[model samples]
Target: MPRTQAGDPLTERTIRVLDAVLDDFGGRRFAVRDWTGRRHDPPGPAEFELILTGPGSLRAMFFPLNDRTFGEAYVTRAIDVEGDLVAAMRVAYTIIETRVPAAVRARQLRLLLTLPRAGTGRPRELRARRGGRAHSVARDRRVNDFHYSRSNDFYRLWLDEWMAYTCGYFRTDADSLDAAQVQKFDLVCRKLRLREGDRLLDVGCGWGGLAIHAARHYGAVVHAVTNSTAQAELAAERVAAAGLAGRCRIELTDFRALDDTRRYDHVSSVGLVEHLGPAVWRTYLAKVWRLLEPGGTLLNHGMTGKAGEPVGSPFLDAYVFPDARLMTIGATVRAAEDAGFEILDVENLRRHYARTIRAWRERLDAAEAEAVALVGDRTVRVYRIYFAGLEHAYRRGRINLHQTLLQKSPAGRTDLPMSREDWYAPPQR
Candidate 1:
């Protein structure tokens, strides 16, 4: 690394820390050490600069007290990555492992668990623009933009080749994301009791993963709805490619626009309720209630809260997912009942989510460079911290995930189905 021109203490310390971390990683990976200041065969500045300035480039952001603030700033986009995001992540991880002692790391972890967050305060500018109905024309567009508007290239880094943005179903320690996503898709299909010629509706479909799977594997006609325009277009293209365009349709709209005249035999939503906001959970369930045909089954796969209401993670609200809310199992069940759906089953896959998130974060760490090149440093940092924090939360049991099976009663009876023969994969254990 080059010497600080002004010999400032913070800059000097940062450079030293960066160098030490890079050196350690180089030792582990047996990769060449590329330092700008030290006498090493480092990557050329022009090459490094290109890694930063080109599309998908990521620049590293260094801070004086990473333990104190990096996590929150990343969530807020307060810290930016300029170029070569993957390299930046490798560097950051190395710095943490080498520059910070184990004792300090433990202390930081404890602090994170106990620290209170700032009040739920939206930016003044954002407050000025609060629109009616969280998912209204303006607010809906903003929510879509907050997530799907991100670069496909950026998503490609951590997500499976199919670009599944929902949770994965881990069957074994050896199952890769490619296999796990397939597993998850099959699981949902089985749980919903999909049958040939059955019509299915996917609410909050992300890139139409579940819809495409059902139509292709189960021979079901599918209609999918999403709030993101990017997802709708991509899903349409995928459906057409699979020659399921006739069988599956992707709609770029909200659930409120659904025509009540139409009903599906099967319904599934994955990881979508988080964006529904706390105030609308009941209303959203009512929409689901009205969308399902009599005797139809609805599968809601979402992350749940261990406790009702907020824990005040301002960073998550401001940077990661704006206006997102999590509901406890008790509240979610009541909401379903209020919508007049009988809750036939509730399965908590909390541990699976912990493993799933770990897998995702690891994959993101591995593909950091490609991600940064696509989105830039700030976004890369945002994802890294977000993934890490989420992993911690899940492992600590502060959050939960569930796959609830709800049914719209035909004769107001819950004992219609006796055979669960096809409702699950063979015991993997």
Candidate 2:
């Protein structure tokens, strides 16, 4: 807390109220400084500092005291995180988890009343547009355009060579993003037991990474689907460049729009389930099941919410992914089972995601100027916050990355090996 200044009751009151509200935050690894340039250090070493620029900044940060408002303050420069952003994010998350008493809330509002009120910044474009039924095909197209229609160059700035947008598997912190992404794609293909001339379907195939991998490395015939127009165009270009034009096809449409005339030996849906509503879980999985040949495997990779974690990031929904929503792992598995897919394997990749997001954040920070030029300053700022928040969430187990392996198995028949030994065995000499 700030030292009591003589004849400065306002400072004293602000300190008391803010401190009291944050009393539950015992692990204060970061300091909080008010607008007056007064730094209030916690009782120990600090890795970062939360800097509030003015009275409006304080109001914007603490009035509602949620993820969305705190995000707004940062995007508009009302509040700032000095020093390590991830460390500061840790502290901010703790504060959000702190439940203020009703008395504290009352005192905060009363104190805010005396402070000047201005420049909280305009609200975000809510869910890209309101009034439509959530997750409808038309509404979803608009949402995809809002989030994914940004310059492909912007994403290419940080993503790997394949431009895979999903989480990558990491053996250690030292692995490069490209290496991890290769391992991830190959891992998915190996899990499906891909072979030459086998048909593979990739739904929600961002930038066509997995499809390209299946075709180039596994020699599988690839058919990929994506709703983002930008993704479809770029992926098509990439496919042709890889000289797999005859074997690979990129479809510019939603996964649901696919005709029933075709089926695949393997189906992969990575980083897409979160964009689907929980109510549509059965429908989505059933579609994947119908698209897969009996005895074929389907790899469903996505981030899911834990039972007790905070529901969703309003900031993410508004600014990052307008249609994203997480369902619990158990719920996801149950849905797949109900959709006629037998659960074969479930592995959590939470730590991998932490490293993946951290790498992206650091890469973005290093290429700040290029990113800003490509997508403008606001988008860069929003994504920086998005990465930091996600890294923190993964570290805290608020979210999980699940690679759920399901099979369109006929009873007692699921091709070959009964054990997972081959899944991790060393390569033959």
Candidate 3:
């Protein structure tokens, strides 16, 4: 950490640059606390404050002026956020994307040059570095293991009773996480119109939440696949305990490895496509198409992003789901159409997902002690920030959750009800 001398030009320049950027963001109601306990308050009511750990924190925060930098600053404890992390993140993002005059930019560059280029290193065991080509079957397996295999007990701290890791469909503000998750599973079942004795394929299934629900409630025989060892074991145990062992099979295998000869009445890929990589979108859809019986429906649920946006912050791509990429809904639909499937429906669950992440964030924050005990301090911190950032991303539309329905219409035949009322209506007694 460098010390700022009294009356130093860098000190004045840093203040000036901060003033300019804060004004550029319309003087957002956030404050900043320097290492010396000096306060830089905004003009109005404040929701959060950024506390710099040392003089080098400024360097770590704005040296490159990117999402990864801001995220790394917090993760490394170079800067700490007190109150409203999402609000602070919004301000940081606005400043990052805000344009300024050439003169102001020059001053910012000068101040950045005067500060130390590095911080006190990163958080312990924070970065996840994987070798081999991105999205390769072997690498994808390792990536899934890195994220999903970090102790099922840790996930139990935050996720719902079913441990449905993807977005949950919240019908209203009063929907509990557990109920919403069940609704999400049922929503998938209804969209596919899953029925008794129907063969279902749940690819990239996390803990087999959907499989168990589909079998127990809908009487669908499900073959769920996952690349995670812990998930497969736990999901199988849950399935057996529920007395659905004969109906639901949890297989620890990549979706690509499934033999095409074995087909299914419905293919539901929730939270799986993002990892298949954009280049393989065509082949990925084709694989699902081949595995589905004629007139069978496929429910593709996953995250999406607008074109030209980065897949995610560098911190996310490196540490979480390293093989994942978010393609826009349009591209996803086009790929499905190219794979010989008729587009049935595309519903954006972005708002519901925001609510879902908010619940997870609150639950995780409440169980921070248990999470830290189970997975260590660094893992807990990483995930806390991850959930917060994700919630902000979804709320602000930087990303979205799309549940798309497609069908292999044999000779232009269809099985879907005429309206969405059947999908959302209450169950019959």
Specify the highest-TM-score model's number: 3
Best by lDDT: 3
Number of clashes recorded per candidate? 16, 0, 0
Q: Given candidate 1, what's the lDDT at residue 116? A: 27
Residue-level lDDT of model 2, residues 1-429, one tens digit each, is 434334345544555656665555654456767767677776777788878677666667655767877777788778889788877677667777656787866765676565555486744633367348988888888888788888888898899988889889886678899989988987888788899999999988889989998899889999999989999999999999999999999998887788887988988889989999787667778787777787988889999999977768878888888768899999899888877888889999999999999889988989999998987777788898889989988998989999999998888486657777766653332
How do the residues 209-292 of candidate 1 rate in per-residue lDDT, one tens digit apiece?
889989988889999999888888888999999899889999998888899889889888898877775657777788777877
User: Against the true structure, what is each candidate's TM-score?
Assistant: 0.71, 0.93, 0.93
Q: 208 in model 1: Cα distance from truth in Å?
A: 1.3
In candidate 3, stretches whose alpha carbon ends up further than 4 angstroms from where it belongs are: 1-15, 99-107
Please give the CA lDDT of all the candidate structures: 0.66, 0.81, 0.82
340-407 in candidate 3: lDDT tens per residue? 99998999999989999889989998998998899887678678777878888898898989999999
